[model samples]
Target: MLNLGTVLAFGALVLFGGWAVAAGVATRSLSAVNAVFLSYVASLTLVGGYVLSVRRPISGTGTDVAFALLSGAFLAIGSISFYAALERGSVAIVSAIAALYFVVPVVVGVLYFEADLSTANVAGIGLAIVAVVLIAS
Candidate 1:
């Protein structure tokens, strides 16, 4: 049986998949920067409203706040680059290539966090490499 986290994650995947398709379609009419800007504005409003409704304290350590800002910077950069790529390239190819971003965190987890890579994880990484090569060619 799927746990709550797994169910929520699946829901997120479904929503994100729909968002990706909508983004690709919308980018045809809007510039990448504009699209990202508008999309994030909406994101902020919704998320901010949720926080307000929850009445949760927005407390975090200095380091946590700094890390969150840094993460947002990275996400903004990546989103702009991705949207730009989608503008100039085939959406299918661009998305497939972009989807390999999971490898970065996987590598960090293994190398820096001392996370173990089981046989299936290794096989998935190998298959991801092969998929990239096949897609790029």
Candidate 2:
């Protein structure tokens, strides 16, 4: 049976794939900066709702909190930059490159965290590289 994490991962894959397409469609007539602005407005509205409904304390060490904040800043920068790329590029190619974002964490995990570089994992990353190359052609 699939675990909750697996189920959630699949759900996210579908949801974000659809979101990417929608983002590209929405960007068709928008300026890159304007697209970023519209997206932030929508995102902030949801963040506000979640903040209002929070019931549990946000628990983390100072270092952990700093890392989280830093990561969030990178996420915003990447998301806004992606929207800018979508405004000027084909969704197919831009999304393919964006999908490779997974590689960063995987590589870092292997190098910094001593995460296992199993054959299967390496092969999967190789396949992803191939997919991106094919998508670009």
Candidate 3:
């Protein structure tokens, strides 16, 4: 049976599939900083509303807070760089190169989290890397 987490993950995938296109199109009409700031505003409002509605506890340990802050920092850096690239470069190549961001999580999962992956998972990652290289080049 498909769980809520699985379903939400798939939904996120669908939503994100159009993100590069949206960014590319928007950057054509808007400055990169303006586009990114507008996105941040929307994301903050939506996510903040959802959290408030859920009434979920947001408190965490110091380590957890530090990690969250660090994650946000990295996200800000990446998003700014990506939107800037989109403003000046081909969306396809920029998005292709940005897709390599997943490698960080995969490596962290395997090393720190000790996540196990099947042979197929490994092959898929390898193929994704090759595809990005081919696409970007």
User: Compared with the true structure, what per-residue lDDT tens digits does model 3 show for residues 52-73?
Assistant: 9999997999999999999999
List lDDT for all candidates, in order.
Answer: 0.88, 0.90, 0.91
lDDT winner, 1 or 2: 2
What ranges in model 3 sit over 4 Å off?
116-119
What TM-score does structure 2 among the candidates reach? Answer: 0.92
Worst ten in a row by lDDT for model 2: 31-40
Off by over 4 Å in 2: none
Candidates 2 and 3 compared by TM-score, better number: 2
Task: Mark the 10 consecutive residues where model 3 has the least summed lDDT.
Answer: 12-21
Give me the displacement of residue 67 in model 2, in angstroms.
1.1
TM-scores across all candidates? 0.92, 0.92, 0.86
How many clashing residue pairs are found in candidate 1? 0
Best by lDDT: 3
Q: By summed lDDT, which 10 consecutive residues of candidate 1 come out lowest?
A: 14-23
